[model samples]
Target chain A: GAGVSQTPSNKVTEKGKYVELRCDPISGHTALYWYRQSLGQGPEFLIYFQGTGAADDSGLPNDRFFAVRPEGSVSTLKIQRTERGDSAVYLCASSNRPYNEQFFGPGTRLTVL
Target chain B: AQRVTQPEKLLSVFKGAPVELKCNYSYSGSPELFWYVQYSRQRLQLLLRHISRESIKGFTADLNKGETSFHLKKPFAQEEDSAMYYCALYGSGGYQKVTFGTGTKLQVIP
Candidate 1:
């Protein structure tokens, strides 16, 4: 693909349900990231992956929010026992490691009811 | 410990007027700064990076290492410039993980 891609542009789920947000990074990019953005706010860092392993996840708000990039090309952000506060736009971005510009997807809006 | 702060949530300016969107960062290490823009209903895209020291769409950002700031500025704002702007900082968080500011909504009124 020419750019980063996210699935199901919008999702609405009831609290306590599980939801998975998918992201497809640009082919061959070695770095992938997940961020969350609340209404009228900028994206907040959640996690970063270098290949199959998460290199840094300190930004994740809690254990309820998790992300995985098993093969480095595609990633998924999983929210377990979703809460109403989890409602926001989940964004995915990719870059070619350090010193490269990040390309972001259109984002997936997750609305927890 | 690392963070980016964009003070304004919204900014409105007339076409052809000068515009500046402030971005300040807090990080212990050297910072690589960038400006990302999102137009209404469009994907987020890179506008420019301080390391490149290049201007795109008549906008430029100067990174002041001493101040830990990378503010985007344009001498003349255009109606097309009306969009959302986010400032970010990337560093050795293993693979260049970036921290972003809250973003500013730039509304250029004609």
Candidate 2:
């Protein structure tokens, strides 16, 4: 696409429910990243995908947070048994290649009620 | 452990005033520093990276290796300069290992 694209700019889900956030990176960007941003803080890295494999998933808070880049183009962030504390803006970014500047999308603001 | 620290959470300056946003990092190896900005209801975008050595929007940041700092500066602040500024770092070790500081919000009053 043009810039990075995230789905359902806002989402409200109940606790214990499952939510998925999607990201469509810019064309030809091989490195995709997922981040979480709280109300008053900068975005924190959650996971990074280089090509079809996850290059780094060290930042995932716990087992409930998972992500996948099946095709290396679009990615999805899945949260299982969501909690209210999970409420925040989920950001997605992608770079042309490794060690390059990332372009971010309009983040998906998730609200777990 | 590598970390980025942005001490000030809020800064207000009159238009044409000089502005500076502080950033400090702790890392064992070399650092790749960058400043990202977010305007009202906008996506986060790169303002500048220390490696590029280019200034954008009348702002510049010099990476001081001795102090482990990369401070953003503007000689004359404009209302458009108001935004959330984040200090980020990527180490030479991992390709995707990046850390960001708690952002500083700048308000340039016209």
Candidate 3:
């Protein structure tokens, strides 16, 4: 019973660089979500995927942020031209269904210098 | 737009004292509310959902639709209760969008 897991627990990159954060949800989880949490703030939802399609991506801050969960399993959050403001923890969560309790990953700490 | 608000950023209480965390949300349709807690060095996990109506770890939250609030309460706080608590809201919209409030840090002093 592996829970959600995010790779590159800590990542550091220069401003204007591109970075990607990956997440592996629990087996059999059909719903996956991405969120970003800034210091001293709550997680801000980025996007959600049901099966293979993104159900909602309104939380994405700007055009530079994008995510995909193809084949309905692993997900990746990509940031183009990362900015200093993008320094935060990128969290991923998954659940068996939309209404079920979600399980979260440890989160990837992304730092844009 | 739907929003969840946690008014207090931090709350400290002595051991055995009563504890309460306030949460308020705004949504037009029926909403699903949940309390998620994250202990030191641990991933965020669900504590309880309003739909279940069952207390977990001596903590209970009553959803007051009229007040548009869901407040978590525990009669006797313990040192282990120290953690960050987040109130989440899920609207009835088709996308199943979920929103979390700015968490509240609970400090239980022994």
Among these predicted structures, which one has the highest DockQ? 3
For residues A58-100, could you state the per-residue lDDT of candidate 1 as single tens digits? 7799999888887768999999999999999999999887568
Query: DockQ scores for all the models shown?
Result: 0.71, 0.74, 0.86
Candidate 2, residue B93: Cα displacement in angstroms equals 1.1
Model 2 spans with C-alpha error above 4 angstroms:
none
Provide interface RMSD per model, one decimal: 1.6, 1.2, 0.8
Root-mean-square deviation of Cα positions for candidate 2 versus the true structure, in angstroms:
1.0
Per-model clash counts, in order, read: 0, 0, 0
What clash pairs does model 3 have?
none
TM-score of 2: 0.97
Candidate achieving higher TM-score, 1 or 2? 2
- Tens-digit per-residue lDDT, B51-109, candidate 1: 89999999999999888889999999999999999998887645456788989999999
The parts of candidate 3 lying over 4 Å away from their true place are: none
- lDDT of candidate 3 over A15-68, digit per residue (tens): 999999999999999999999999999999999899989999889999999998
Report the error of model 2 at residue B2, Å: 1.4
Q: By TM-score, is 2 or 3 better?
A: 3
Pick by lDDT: 1 or 2, better one: 2
Top candidate (TM-score): 3
- Which pairs clash inside model 1? none
